[model samples]
Target: MVDRESDTYSCECAMFEHMGILCRHALKVMVHVGVCRIPSHYILKRWSRDARDVLPDHLKCYQKDSD
Candidate 1:
């Protein structure tokens, strides 16, 4: 189900809740509703291309390697 007011979505598949990934059903709903982009909250940092570029404040002391 898509809740426009809260910008939340749910599916009987429970893929997002279980795997932290948006399911095909949810994607279809988003497309049908004309949502051009996926919300930031749904994009896990670990899954992004720049995931390694960012570190928590507590781990900031560590530096990334050039190679």
Candidate 2:
């Protein structure tokens, strides 16, 4: 059934783990629903290189002035 396939895809794509971003399965659903643009948040998250910057500035010991 289509519902089962969709559910499987959603699980496989890990959509439930990240609601803020669409997994590939969600994108497929969007295509089925005739959605375009795929939203900047999703695409941005996919292509973003900023994930490495999530650590706090203070966490970088080298960046602190030598005591």
Kindly list the per-residue Cα lDDT of model 2 for residues 12-62, writing each as its tens digit.
656546665666667777678666665544454434665445546777565
TM-score of 1: 0.73
Pick the lDDT winner: 1
State TM-scores per candidate: 0.73, 0.36
The superposed Cα distance between candidate 2 and the true structure at residue 13, in angstroms, equals 3.7
Residue ranges of candidate 1 with Cα displaced over 4 Å? 53-67
Which residue runs of candidate 2 sit more than 4 Å off their true CA positions? 1-12, 15-22, 45-67
Q: Pick the candidate with the highest TM-score.
A: 1
- Go through the candidates in order and give each one's C-alpha lDDT: 0.87, 0.54
Model 1 root mean square deviation, Cα atoms: 4.1
Per-residue lDDT of candidate 1, residues 14-36 (tens digit): 99889999999999999999999
In candidate 1, which residue pairs clash? none
